[model samples]
Target chain A: MKKFINQADDFIPEMLAGIYLAHPDALRCVNDDPHCLARVGATPGKVAIVTGGGSGHLPLFLGYVGEGMLDGCAVGDVFQSPSPEQILAVTQAVDTGAGVLYLYGNYNGDIFNFDMAAEMAEMESDIRTRTVVAADDSAGAAPSGEGNASARRGVAGIFFVYKCAGAAAANGGCLDTVARVAQKAGDRVRTLGVALSPCIVPRIGKPGFQIGDDEMEIGMGIHGESGIRRGPTLPARQIADEMMSWLLADSPCQSGDEVAVLINGLGATPLEELYLMYRHVHHTLSQSGIRVFRVWVGEFATAMEMAGMSISLMPVDEELKALLAREANTPMFRQFSA
Target chain B: MKKFINQADDFIPEMLAGIYLAHPDALRCVNDDPHCLARVGATPGKVAIVTGGGSGHLPLFLGYVGEGMLDGCAVGDVFQSPSPEQILAVTQAVDTGAGVLYLYGNYNGDIFNFDMAAEMAEMESDIRTRTVVAADDSAGAAPSGEGNASARRGVAGIFFVYKCAGAAAANGGCLDTVARVAQKAGDRVRTLGVALSPCIVPRIGKPGFQIGDDEMEIGMGIHGESGIRRGPTLPARQIADEMMSWLLADSPCQSGDEVAVLINGLGATPLEELYLMYRHVHHTLSQSGIRVFRVWVGEFATAMEMAGMSISLMPVDEELKALLAREANTPMFRQFSA
Candidate 1:
């Protein structure tokens, strides 16, 4: 395993320290706990949005903490959920007179801890909190007709949830409104990913799964979870078309519908290839008579050094579109009006 | 080799088409040639800055062509210099009454072609052009005291050149002033890189170079060029200390200097590892009494999917710092004020 690391046990702390050092003006640790990070200053009387998830996905949970984005994040170890104490710490630090909202991916571990954190906040500090979990992975266990989003696992499409919900909170929306927006965005977005290679967790020092060099897994989860299909690596256009078909079929959109597209690199995939995928995705969308309002092509979320890409489509209304276009200044994402 | 590609020959054109498709509002093709890309609407009366180099380095040559940055870019094939005609096309399209400035990395093929393009622009269109070649790799052929920077290879530190020089042009500086600022930034920046593995060029379906599984090459160039040293991979801190020693030794920074740091991933390294490296870089600089003004940690320049990173340092003065802080909205980068 060729990695730039020191002691494996110190990985999370060291990375957190590095982030704080690099962007000291934009982010800070909460309650003297490095695992609980928040923006430098929390705005009073504004709904505070907090998220928490396992590590390995940069720009996902913690990287969104900044102005016009997430207010705080409770970081966890690799593929492991953060403790309830850490989540509560972030919630308390970010909450002002307004209530706190726990927005994160829908994982059993994360959900349990966040719920505990919410209960702890209510019992200990009398701070009200709400939850809006993102479960936008179209290829997850949930089927579209079942309407059981809680059975799905959130992936890169969670970015849309963060963008819409964070913007609502930044716009001084009430906590209930922010949670509603988060859930709406979460419901509207769908994601599908392909994995060419697996990433090694620091402590493990070996890849979690193995595949042939010329093979790939479609609909792979971020943490090397078994994908829906496995086959020989296909051409860029074919891969993009197949992924788009799955996403579009699962998403609720029609002819004349407008949406946003996110072509995300799952770590080692180059931006050049990401854009190539975007070309086909755009072409596919146009053929279906769908209008693309805005597009983002880069590594918004990653799975360590895994090699692959994920396509996310979010059908947007005027409300969601405005929030998506709002200026976001974060460690990992920045958006300005065109 | 595992790669997401169709025909190897279609790599550059397809990638260019994808870029134009994804960012139609911010960028446009020049003279019907996709290889020549320019900002959608160039700001007339402002000195135009045009840069070009081989493909594969996204955000390096074309990714910088947006607001507050380069006015145009002449894209070449993967690792192959673009034709002089392509460069001329970009120059002619972006240049207004104010002459153009040609800024790019110092390479034999690129310098020869860009110089020829300048002559063509002057003779055919009467659009005057000045040239500034970035040569900031501290580990290249040039020795620190040799007074021959031309022997050095331009690596990730060239980003400082684009950021500073692009800001000068955007601020309505004349061609001479912008060229001077570009040269000054090129002189102040120093870069060094390490490679744990090699990348495969698309046309050539094999790794460009090879190394043992446990070995790493320090001071390696972006294109798998031979480095200053090779040995077993060391811990993150030790690697940081060693690379910092080499960079600081070759640079002109003193104890009380203020500098901007860029920890660039050479493709496959994870953000977690990049921050671990940054933590050590920051600690080492602080211990030496060198204040870090700003830092950027991401894949600024990459070598396809090679697994490694590069460290770039530019000792900044008031002038350079102001330019670095200017707002830039590009396809790949966006910066806003605090």
Candidate 2:
């Protein structure tokens, strides 16, 4: 049970304080609330894109706050949803003259908390709010996307959703348009992850289950959600092939379809291994004649020190491609569209 | 010895293969030498910047090559220097009509190999080259910078040096000017690192050194170089305060001086913790009345999976500040000045 933390209870506040110190030019905490952060001077006339969820997943929820991305984020403790009060504070802090667009993963805690905040915003303050759930973990849904994507857990593909929606909002697109594009990107993007190790929540302990040295679980979620199966550890290429099989099964990415590929390292997985995994993913996608519009490989979202990786693909139409290519820079996640 | 690598012997090549796959847009292997990678189509008339060092420190030597950054990087085995031949290949691959500039940490192996490569380039290929040795680790040298800073080890401060020199060269500075800026940057930056946990090199085990559970080493190098001393573990703020004391003692940053701060995580440390460390660093600098021109918090350099962090500060004159604020984007590090 070795870890690097001060008082386990002081984790969230100390971490938020650190973010503010490091990114003063781009970010700031809201009204002395460490858990609620907003971009420095979000565009006054644009739709405010706000999101929140658990902590522990670096570059997610918080890291995407900046121009061309989120306007504000409500941060929770590790893997725990932000309280409704935290969400409401962030929602009020970043709302410009325009209404607010809420973006977050489709977890139950997040849904409940955000729903509560949205109701409060409507009743208490005359603010209009909309939400587009990011349920992009395709394997968490049915083998096919008939109706199960609604039930699937959200994972790293939320980055893509944020980018698409944020860019549209930054360009003065209305809240409905931003939400529509976000929903489209969220619907098109499919993700599948595999874990070779389990991690702990410092406040809690190690995840309840154990994984052996030679074993791995496919379709693992960031918070150690139940995967479909567990078996002997496969090589990088096989892992890519197996994940791609499920990814393609849920949503058929046909020949000539363009996609943006993201190979996200889940915590302890090395960047080198993630790229090795990407090599196979690229080859497999090419074999199926799917055109790679672009590729992103790095630690985008993580679960503490879980030694695993997730491959997410967002099939792009013209509008999605243009939005994905827009410029954005936060502390952790960044892209230069030019 | 839990690591996410495939074959033990194929480590370097496989890792490079993954890098190429993930970053074909920014980098390409030179002369089919997996150990040598160069930015694709470097500016044809600008003085080229090239660097190399051991592998395992991902996003370091190789990941820094792209627009407004290094033109090339020669890679080595995990924590081992690349061959002189590999170095020469990268030097020649990125050489524009303008001469080449070599940049690297002041490691023994790196100095020897890069020196040999520069000699070969001059003698055989008629290419002129200059070198900048970054020796920024304050604790790795004598207590004072009067004469001993020349012998200090290079760690995360090397990133600042690269940013300064690369931006200078990208601004069309001549080879000599670029070399001058790089040397000035190398001299002005000071860094101090502490390791709470030691990491292993996959080939061999933990370099035959052990620190007790309650103990930590201050001023540890990336290769676990001998630090100033060992003592009981401290909290994050205290670690920042202690490291700042050594950093300021070596290179006094007076009030009204502006500086760039980087809180680098040695592998296995979480970003949340790194940000927390930056919080204390910013507070200490503010107390000193030193302005933070910029702040970078994340893994710039690492000893694979070592649970510790280092703080680097470079007193930025007007020139160094502009160079740092210049735009740059490789796979891992990026900033847009707009």
Candidate 3:
């Protein structure tokens, strides 16, 4: 497909420059590498929070880096993880005197690069580092790997962990404390997404996958991985039930547990339909005796205009709730009550 | 062309039911009419803000209604305005002890219906009402209707007004004051949008307009209205200039005017490209002596994967700046002052 880019290789650099210009008050590019985008006036003594991913997810990586959320973000090309060098650059730039914490989705390439970068930071700089990978998608894991690393896959639910972890780090928590809170939030969270159609990456010009007009793939990965099953499109109620069943099965919380519900539209799904799905999700959660402390329903994490929805549930205790409620001033995340 | 909806007629009601169920704490349906959605704790006496449009724009009308934002929203069918009766029902339900203020995009059908509803409420009830139409699209106005009524087409910039007006109303501003602020925001605001491709309504199953792969339309309206001109697809920088020129002309403020800039992706544009465009927009604004106080870049107002972007400039004054700086806690908007 045709794109407006001048050259494929320059896409990331040019985009970062643009972001810096538009949001000079809120963000600035690292003076050295230019690829590392950091929040303006990020605290120096706090455990810095760094995240990076492909560039297509606008607010996901860049928009989240501001006042109360991410300290810095390294953006790669569309739908592709940044290189190890880029990740390390962002890590080094955001590392305050207290060290740095790495937070990102559980994509395979991202994990490899971020892990390598963490090791490099520890050896090269005096910076201590911790990693909390978001593995919230329950649809990708088998029942046996319910809570295991092998079965966990990160989806849109990463935003919640970013909120909780960023607040923890911003509040003067050490690397260990911030990582623990993020891990706890990740463990309690479960997400399942479905896509009606595949997204067309501008570089590729065509969809990454082919979905029939009459069908939708459940349990699909964010990168359009093959889902558990492809079946006739079901009603919103049925879809909500199917996804919620998998999420609840993977979650350790009981019916009496308090949680936050995020009914995210996978790009093309309208808000009206999202609310419909949220209705079903709320009813299902109510039937299970879960008390939803908060509800976030929108395109928090989107895949272009891919039509579908994902449901993420995060069990919240007093501490997690407090972190989630803390005042956050990021472009995409804002919760004023701690 | 297929859609998840069961029937064209059932679309709105089904979606409303789902929203109420999902956000029982944040939103509620009118006792009798399910189509009217209101915030849960929105009592009378507070200035009520109501906005609505077609159903396709997800977070725009419905997702925007929550804490610190809209008091209520009346959702129409896909890409269609709500009936006069529907608008009246929501206005009556939302009018607490104070009067109601109607805020929405500038579209003929919406204006006609909302005006009728406001008149009905004045005649039948003790509530007073005022209206502020978000006519920010600089491309759609005919040369004759230049000022308040002309040069008015509401696209994505409405989100900014919602935040500013909602904050004012939520702070207990009287209906007149709320209307004044909203109108001021609308007046200072100017938006220009262009589309690479037209959006297909779920029920329509075909694109609203046609464009070649190598061509783009400038100054297009959200609902397939004609733009300024159709030309070969241009680079990001050139496209940014085309959009900025219109916005600058539409604004009454001159160079040195501090304004809030919103670089909105029309659903399909990638974040990477958005930043690229943002870069050009920032440089152009600086060259013109405009001081950008705040810049928000994202898919705030989308047109169902239509490949385009819109730029909105709202000249800021003390009151407008304060309202913009005030905390907004909604599903879609969250701003934290550093």
Q: How large is the interface RMSD of candidate 1? A: 0.8
lDDT of 3 at A37: 78
List the candidates' TM-scores in order.
0.98, 0.94, 0.89
Candidate 2, position B38, lDDT: 88
**Model 1, position B58: C-alpha lDDT score:** 71
**Cα RMSD to the true fold for all candidates:** 1.6, 2.5, 3.3
- Candidate 3's C-alpha runs over 4 A off are A2-4, A42-45, A143-148, A203-205, B2-4, B42-46, B66-69, B96-98, B142-151, B170-173
Please name the candidate that would achieve the greatest lDDT relative to the true structure: 1
B46-101 per-residue lDDT for model 2 (tens digits):
99999999987777878899888899888888889999999999998989879999
Instruction: Tell me chain A's TM-score in each of the predictions.
Output: 0.97, 0.97, 0.93
Query: Which sequence of candidate numbers ranks them by lDDT, best first?
Result: 1, 2, 3
Residue pairs with backbone overlap in model 1: none
Stretches of candidate 1 exceeding 4 Å from the true structure: A141-147, B141-147
Please provide, for model 3 over A1-338, each residue's C-alpha lDDT reduced to its tens digit, 9 standing for 90 to 100. 43546655676678778777766677777756666778878576888999988766656777788766889887777788887788787877777778788899888899999988888888888678888888888875754345466566788889889888988988889888999999999888888888888876766768999988889988887778777778988866677788888888877768899998888777656556676677777888899999888887766777765777788999899998888888877655556664
| Comparing 2 and 3 on lDDT, the stronger one | 2
- Candidate 3 — number of clashing residue pairs? 11
Categorize the docking of model 2.
medium
Q: Please give, for residues A68-122, the per-residue lDDT of candidate 2 as tens digits.
A: 9899999999999999999999989888868899899989999999999999988
